[model samples]
Target: MMVQIENKIILVTGGAGFIGSNLCEYLLSQRNKVICLDNFATGKTSNIQHLLSNPNFTLIVGDIRNLSDCHKAVSGVDYILHEAALGSVPRSINDPITSNDVNVSGFLNMLVAARDAKVKKFIYAASSSTYGDSEALPKVENTIGKPLSPYAITKYVNELYADIFFHTYGLNTIGLRYFNVFGRKQDPNGAYAAVIPKFVMQLMKYESPIINGDGNYSRDFTYIDNVIQMNVLAMLTENPEAMNTVYNTAFGDRTTLNNLMEYLKKHMSQYDEKIASVEVIHGPNRAGDIPHSLASIEKAKKLLNYNPEFSMKDGLKEAVDWYWNNLK
Candidate 1:
């Protein structure tokens, strides 16, 4: 049975962010009324500025750290997609306390608010970083290792509290462990910028992009469209085996940094011929970095009927086009 999400009042926390804004746009396109809560901490208003005219979209500028703000945002909402968090391992390493305050404490505030509101289901953006130091090829939900950073610890804690909420308070929740998601609307001008967007931006300017490792580290570079699909499926799924469980939301493939650089250089050269000659410099491996990551999405497949529609190559082409047209 296919789940139809129509006319539902959904609260999308951090909807001004890269993933959150994309999710809000998708939900609005589906005829759902979306309330976007964001503090502009890491999220930018430009991401959601275009959606301001949509009648189905409501924007609330507020911090998640405040319980009253979360309480107000979750009110009268049918579902909660908690996407507000301080991401990036280096950022967390630079300031562990602030990261914990936002990712851990702020997460609890949202959970409490959603539970009180009696929202149908709560979905959050978990991370593949939770599989830190495991050395596992294809990471499964139940199998994990010791967290390598403060950011990893914060995300794993989200899963812990979510499970306790289900068992102790009977609040239904789902977590999607995302692996290296990238695409349109992703910010490339930040100190904690992700690899794909940053690299693309650097290449567009004909600048050398730095590879953080020996160019051998690999990741499941998921596209944002696929992430949107996973979120929608997690929220709408009615399968008895699906609720209260975490799923790995990835394309079930991996790409090394070196190969990814070559792919990006080839793709970007189509727009600017000079990009073909861009050099990539290798640097020391980053702290709290994983060597390789791949996801076994079988659980998401069987339980939520999640069918990822875009590969890295296909998604990157579309993303690069968007960046070329918009980010200039």
Candidate 2:
């Protein structure tokens, strides 16, 4: 996947958020002009504050719900990594309208802008929740089930719209259906914070972490680097088969909630031994929560030649170190 890195203007919507910020930083390191569009609703200034002074970095404070904002952001962008959306199943479950507005309507706005701008490609953040209610192990790209949550519905609609754009307007698009992603810069606060970061912060504080189910529920829990790699390949790939499709962006492994806590405790304990003594509590399985989730990344591996560099253990250890040093 080592093609000559081009000096193109790229727009990362939600570039002030966790994954988008990381992508922005990496793109900047490669000396590309990066335009970041965010409303700061979920995105934070702290994430992109480090890049404010960089010559190639620009942040447009705007919402994607406004087609004008999307048009303004995409004006000279060579590619669009459309990561702007309201994430979190619980959040979507609690307020489907807001999530629908941002994730659905906002996504359409970006697509129209990208198509009108004639961007080279549109790579977006799809979700593993698209596999909703399916009882299959190692979920594949084609075999999908009925969506269980409003969040899943929005992500699935993204794929459908992406397909239509390619067919109707010849806009190339790729959707990365991410699993339980975790790594540095991921927020550990807030009610809808991801499990790994939330647990790491709780353990660091010597507080209890609640497992939603009986601790048997598992997830692929992909690392940010793996996700970044998938995005890059999606953006630069020349294979026609790779276009107008979706791929599972994951580490291709699963860890139970209990096992995840053990790893977090073990890694964070290296910084503060008391974190190991922190108690873990269990609660009733959350509503709309699935028992297990795993992805078959063979499509990405074969099509995108995606070779994930980090395993879940490798990623967890690195994430713990970053949190320990940066958050504390």
Question: What's the CA error at residue 148 for candidate 2, in Å?
Answer: 0.8
Q: Candidate 2: where are CA atoms >4 Å away? A: 1-4
TM-score of each: 0.98, 0.98
The superposed Cα distance between candidate 1 and the true structure at residue 208, in angstroms, equals 0.6
Worst ten in a row by lDDT for model 2? 1-10
Cα-lDDT of candidate 1: 0.92
Give the least accurate 10-residue stretch of model 1, judged by summed lDDT: 1-10
Question: How well is each residue in 186-266 modelled by candidate 1, as lDDT tens digits?
Answer: 999889999999999899888899999789999999999999889988888877679998999999999999999999989
Q: Give the alpha carbon lDDT tens digit for every residue of 234-295 in model 2.
A: 98898999899999999899999899988888877888888888898999988777789999
- Model 1 / residue 224 / CA error / Å: 0.5
Flag regions of model 1 displaced more than 4 Å: 1-4
Q: Score candidate 2 by TM-score against the native.
A: 0.98
**Local lDDT at 86 for model 2:** 97
